[model samples]
Target: MTSDTTRTEPVASPTDRLRRLVARTEVVLWDFDGPICRLFSGHPAPGVAGGLVDWLETRGLRGLLTEAERHTADPQVVLRAVDRAGLGRGVAAELEERLTQEELRATATAMPTAWADPLIRTWTALGVRLAVASNNSPRVIGAYLAGRGLADCFGPHIYGRDAALHRLKPDPYHLHRALNALTAAPAAALLIGDSPVDHEAARRAGVTFLGYARNARKARLLADAGARDVIGSLEPLLRVVRERGPGSAPRPQQHLPHH
Candidate 1:
């Protein structure tokens, strides 16, 4: 007689999940600020946000932002608030330009995320397409990539904030744009990011997401946000990629017809 108890399959470890994700990803959409490098590492976001607020005050438009928004450390918050208020094009353009200038300055001291460079290069060598899907300025992303001599890894496929501040992450506009440009379907792509907004955006875009957290708090945040594959470092991913051997290539997918 057979035993009545049923057997259960063991859950895949984090590294195994990462390996499976990497193996199936034909295109990688990367968030600029956190996963690539700390864009405001030395520059500090609070100072930048304060400067934007100060600029508005100088124009006697401090009343445009609520108290919470005025003090928020994210410059994008300020810009979005101003835009939502239906501020004219001149004000919005100037504010975006100012933020861009600040980002360009921050590039000089931006700290690279360890293992990010090699992972990008390795993925490129394996014939996986790469593009930057970020909320930061494309100009700033370009500068950072160029400085690291990894600009060619992404080419001109960097998508970021522009005049349309409303299209930022959590909106999925940039991710959609990258998918369209790369001619890849959502099912064949993966996005690696740090924030809940990034996870939400990827979910909307129908792309798989991997969370890259440098600390426990971030890992916890991602896990709480429903990210199943969160890693404290990119090293594990790098190890998996290296283990795939130099001759391996991305899994085959039917190319979407270019419009």
Candidate 2:
């Protein structure tokens, strides 16, 4: 049975392995960026002038100028765009300060096409434990849950930066902490993420990884990261968890009647 749980790739033989593996995972740990709540915390959204401001080091118009040079290729036009955009109150400098590590993650965008309540509902009914384990700051993570009415699903038990400073994902520390808190064994916990970092963390922690490849590029990325099973959307994930609620011991084979 343990052998059957290792190969998670949806290939013919390994798919069987993945099935066993997923069946063994009873607890599910989810992330934000490409999985649940996508608020563009780390990088700026596309088409925004000086959008990648959070990554710049200089200050005031200096930072905006830097973002222009780094991203737009044409610094002159980039600066002009920034001026026209009027950036917001203290938006440019405060965004660049990188002061708290939390402020840098300052956006309010939800994962498009995601249905939090329905997904959480099914998992809850199945007795499966769920958690959010992203590196997103508490404020941003909270904002996401609040907007979606998902705060109740996680309560104060999620593992974002607000919960801990565990050097972020791909480290397994957050996952370890979550497992300890939930009182579930590592073998029984599953992690769903869009990045390879999440895959490495699961491998190190001996937890199952279900990669949600919301896009074509990410789908390939997750596959390359040793994802056991990859899906283009959350609905398939919901199906996996519901159809295969962690592997349980199969019923003992019946003995033939003595003839």
Candidate 3:
């Protein structure tokens, strides 16, 4: 299904982007990283939405994170563990703290190509609840949001590690957690993200996937994998939610809102 999804004259606009995105479904189950947040690792780092990821892997590091941590994947929990691991290489505990401080001073965590705040606001305004299903440490996710002043964008529904030790994305555990949290269901929900990993995770979990074209090649791969929809912008996806109406998408993944 990884074919290029080409649609000329997108029936979407900046002002009505959220409205259009909301048309296709209800709750918007979103991915982090290239979709909502941007990583601000320095120098050799290619920066968010660029080849920073490739840069990291090229450095023998999966990311600013450690090995066991990269395997963790879910930003919601991985960083939290890494923060405590003090066990990994690359970033010494002291150095991690120092760099994290530096990152906080500059990056706002939102992708230049994304408008996470409005997307959330529109969904909420449409009476649609939002939930996070990431593969990182809750602490890091929390810190990233707070540091960027985006902690309120998702309210308290952020699910991270410490919540589910062995349950992460592509395993469908986070999906289950989101359902429980939002009281949502898989069939009725839609997940939007920018990578094959996100596509695989949603497919394995049984939720509809909307491959955001953050990476053209990855987007093609996701479409080939059977994502229900694909788009380069959040506007169209929001439109999709509105079309789906209330209770039409997957339910929340877990219970309780963190912080």
Candidate 4:
């Protein structure tokens, strides 16, 4: 007679988990607004969203947005709401362009996330592919990256939102595009993002996600979304990458088991 038994594996600490994730990541898909820089840090997102709402009101299209959407701090929320309102392409295009202009202006005062620039450069030097998979317009991403002198780091692999408002995060469209452009398997790519939508997008794309939570609230939000790895700062990741050294060979690609 044989007795039934079950074995449990030891849980990996957060640092160990991050090291393992970084070791296997051949490509990194970065979200723009948070992971790279706070695009609206100087312009302020609430004001930008309000400006868009005010613009729509001037055009007598205020009814297109629900009360909550009109008060949203995220411009994307307003854009998505307008897209779902069955508005004509002309209206959508104008709205998108307005938002794009605001993003462009915001880039003038965009605040880089701590240690982000150095980490990006270090990772690129270490032979890792990089791409910007963001909801911001590619034009804005390009302008900002160019200003930072990091354009060559991503080259043409910067994927962003277009007129198709439905393809944003939680849709996994951009992540898939980045993977295809880099010719990297999903298991070999990792996305560093700051939102639940980013986590969902990575999940759909079969890519690993590392949440960048800049505050306690953001950390809690990512944790609540079932993210297995969350960091309050990019410095830890930067340090880990440095310690891994330039000659560190990438581990074989394998799908990270979902928690």
Candidate 5:
């Protein structure tokens, strides 16, 4: 399904350009972490990472990692390091389960993005197909979506982290899985994500990418990675969809709030 998705619109405003991109998209592949909610807002990620490291120490595997790997705040990095150390299936599975539990706990306080809830609903009503492709576990994504009353919008199209950490993005395995499930051509899909890894995965999968930069730093990161389009806020996209047509759109308001 890999194909070029270059836009042909001439001299359009940024918003108009975005509309054109959206207009061509048939499948919306969303990343679980950023576009939808801040999953680690309440349950800090660093704390969870530390907890994982502690779990390793208790098992007498503390010497397996260098001081830096042991102290790294990214659990994925730690998990991968463990695998490289030949810790085997048992350790990997145990780490994954522990991380899943932590993620489940985090879901209770996951903060939805500013316009994500309503915008997701609006897209659903517009007959646009939606799916989540994330590095997080599918179970956690399902739980969070169900809790927010957004499960029905995506149904069973949630592709998440596999037991093999090596297969995660920017490997494009999960993205390919999502596209395959939807029977979608990559050119006809748009992935809205917040990281360069997401952009790289989308590019490798030949899917159009819409970068969601919640702050200037993220915007710069995406740009540096050669992202053609990145937005600081989803407000403009929400406005376009909300003004698309009768009944399919939400009512226009005096101001579209920023997140």
Candidate 6:
């Protein structure tokens, strides 16, 4: 006789895979600049970088940079160049301090990324340990989080730019520090970031990387960088949170005889 039993299993979709990833994640390492907020939105980053260059020029150190370095608006790149120029500890310290002060000044007008706040709160409510790993200064990050009332959510787990600009993302230094602080396995952590640098660092640290692309071009770039998954919106993640509730694992699949 033919069997007349049937079974149902969860059909995995993109969102399903994302949900599964989150369900297995013990910690979430967030990259501050894009994933969290546009920390340099209101205050133009190029202006800050230009200011750094001008400071060096004031000290008669303008010849220290190549024309390209002086023209670049990226502060981190400029800082790295300064370090590679072997400007000594005093110069590095001063530049880093100046950058930190500019970041702090920008924090007051930093623009929040859409859906990031809710997603963070949802993740926190689900008992996920959260940390910030970024190239920005920790003091600036702490200040921004405090302003957003998210300081207690992450506590002292915020990791950011250290003494050496060369040790930033794509080097896995900050990611390692965050992992150590959480005492969480790399396999059980998820990193959400916007740049390829973040992707590279996560790969080196053996953590699952989720690319948060704000635009189609950025999403394409992340995919080109070999990011397994890229998300342009957090709405799907929010939906998953509502469906699964908090601290719940994915339902196990079941099988039965076919008719």
Ordered by TM-score, highest first, the candidates read 1, 4, 6, 5, 2, 3
lDDT of 2: 0.59
Report the C-alpha lDDT of model 5 over 50-80, residue by residue, as the tens digit. 9989999999988888889888877776777
Q: Tell me how candidate 3 scores on lDDT.
A: 0.56
Clashes of each: 0, 5, 66, 0, 0, 0
What lDDT, from 0 to 1, does candidate 4 have?
0.91
RMSD of 5: 9.2
lDDT of 4 by residue, 63-93 (tens): 8888899899999999898778878778888
Candidate 3 regions exceeding 4 Å error are 1-24, 41-112, 147-149, 161-166, 238-259
lDDT of 1 by residue, 85-126 (tens): 888888888999999999999999999999999999988887
Global fold similarity of model 1 (TM-score): 0.94
Query: How does residue 214 of candidate 1 score in lDDT?
Result: 89
lDDT of 3 at 153: 63
The sequence of per-residue lDDT tens digits that candidate 3 reaches over residues 138-246 is: 5556667676556776677776434333454666676667766666666656777777767887778767776777667866787777664567676655454456555
- Least accurate 10 contiguous residues by lDDT in model 4: 250-259
lDDT scores of the candidates, listed in order: 0.91, 0.59, 0.56, 0.91, 0.85, 0.86
- Tens-digit lDDT string for candidate 2 (1-259): 3555566655565445455655665677887656775555344444333443424334445454543355662212343334445775354234423322332343443444475467776666666667777655555666666777777777676776432223456778777777777767666777888888889888887777878776898888888776767767676545555675433422222222211
Comparing 3 with 5 on TM-score, the higher-scoring candidate is: 5
Could you tell me every candidate's TM-score relative to the true structure? 0.94, 0.64, 0.58, 0.92, 0.87, 0.87
For candidate 5, what is the lDDT?
Answer: 0.85
Task: Score residue 53 of candidate 2 by CA lDDT.
Answer: 42
Worst 10 residues of 3 by lDDT: 43-52
Per-residue accuracy of model 6 over 1-259 as CA lDDT, tens digit each: 8998888896778987887887787888999999999988999999999999999898788888889989887898778878788888788889999999999999999999988888888877777788999999999999999999888889899999966878888888888888877777788789999989999999998899999999998898899899988889877877776676765733323222111
Stretches of candidate 5 exceeding 4 Å from the true structure = 1-11, 64-67, 246-259
Candidate 2 local lDDT, residue 179: 76
Q: Model 1 off-target regions past 4 Å?
A: 1-3, 251-254, 257-259
